[model samples]
Target: MTTSEQLHLPAGSTGRGNYETIIDPGAREGWVHTGLRVLALAPGGSEVVTANGVEAMVVPLNGACDVAVGGEDHHLRGREDVFASATDVLYVPVGSQLTISSKDGGRFALATAVATGSHPVALIRAEDVPVEIRGGGNMTRKVRNFGTVGAFDQMDSLIACEVITPGGNWSSYPAHKHDETVDDGDHQESELEEIYYYEIQDGPSGPGFGFHQTTSSGEDKPIDVLSEVRTGDTVLVPHGWHGPCAAAPGHDMYYLNVMAGPDPVRAWNITDHPDQTWVRGTWESAGIDPRLEGEAR
Candidate 1:
């Protein structure tokens, strides 16, 4: 059994023993179905990333880039940073060759998954994304549903999105899980493996950090993870109820969620923890947190 300490991947630890950090599907034991890679380049830098057996997306974290996929070129109007604005995205099907180049180089995230079907290359613009404000009170947060199940449904197995939690706020709350295939009338839960890639916004003086936890949902498969995550850190959730990602005071928190599973139907059906189910009912009275404004509205 892998310990929680093992699941907490610090920046540069999984750099494929080089200058680049790449977390392939099989990097961690029992984690053999999802992929994420962070690429950093200098000015006028370019790299060719091959999606030999998986479906992938080229997302610019900071600065613009040109992505050449399947004989077509797609230019992404990227943002200054994750905290600045929502950026454009490019999707590449399995067995495709992708060339990512930037005139003024920056960081990029290559999110991939074990593709179940082949789809055409598509470019998802930043302006076209549906920005949503989910939860309320201190639970308020911004969610960019760029590639999730209901927002943009074109992929075969992968589901991806970005979230921003204001300073001192809590998001991904009430603990939830989707680790079982259940069909109860209209309600259904899909068994999925998830990854949390974090980027804590720096304060005026120094760096920042946040806390995350994942516990078993009283199931046969035992799992536990509690970590203090910083920028470039990642946590893997094989099967458990994850929640309450807390952003420390004076520093906002940002994360990119990548998910995929064995279900034939692509969906994100989750079951919240029974004890915390009452939290949802109190949002109406508590009202939404005021700090969540501007970009998401």
Candidate 2:
């Protein structure tokens, strides 16, 4: 058993009123900015979202849908599954009516932040999603930037992205932390709470599984989480060094990351662990794994 299974929320464990799965900052004591909601709809089903003080990003986890926001319908051509390809997304600013409907049944994930910043609504297409191949060798993985910082900078605090690690590979490598708030106009990590929502690809035998690790960074913010994550499972990072998630030999892994913080500047600042920082240097010589090139296409 991994240390501190307290942070691991298995599938169907966090359901609340109206949503099948919901995680809200206001609902959790001491958590201030981030929120996530998973909504499932039957064919021809519809619902209005009441995210009054929050800016939200609608990501379709499976199947297609139409997002009605700002008096317009933003049709999303969602993928068959998370492992297929990057899906379309919609951004809704605060104080707006957000409604979603699908002719065919599917599930959607709403990544949100408690914010008041003003930004126009955007209908981001799937082809426009930036695909990044990061790390090298077995540490290699593909990152899809949908609501990430530089990719889509309309919101105030929300920063979200998708990562796909091939079978038998590792990602979020060389353990890193972004738990300290520093403002000297120089180097310092920003404090942010992160959410990792996982979806593992199935193998020939059965449903897939993987291992996740997040330990303390010795910065007084203690955390210890070693979880065997599966589809629809989630892990919360309040503060710690998180990295080196391992996908089982026959299973590929996909995780959507939702992040937000108290900082005014919308930036992702992180500090790699001193001991494993050296792993980055090796990437200079190590080429990317060939399997990712085909899958990312």
Model 1 TM-score (2 dp): 0.96
What lDDT would candidate 2 get against the real structure?
A: 0.87
- Estimated TM-score for each candidate: 0.96, 0.95
The segments of candidate 1 whose C-alpha lies over 4 angstroms from its true place after superposition are 17-19, 294-297
Model 2 per-residue lDDT tens digits across residues 229-277: 9998988888889987999988999998999998878878898988898
Tell me how far the alpha carbon of residue 265 in candidate 1 is from the true structure, in angstroms, after superposition.
0.8
| Residue-level error in angstroms, candidate 1, position 194 | 0.5
lDDT of 1 by residue, 121-149 (tens): 98999999889888888888899988998
Question: Model 2: runs farther than 4 Å from truth?
Answer: 1-3, 16-18, 183-186, 294-297
Against the unseen true structure, what C-alpha lDDT does each candidate score?
A: 0.86, 0.87
Model 2 lDDT, residue 151, Cα: 90
Quote the positional error of residue 263 for candidate 1 in Å: 0.7
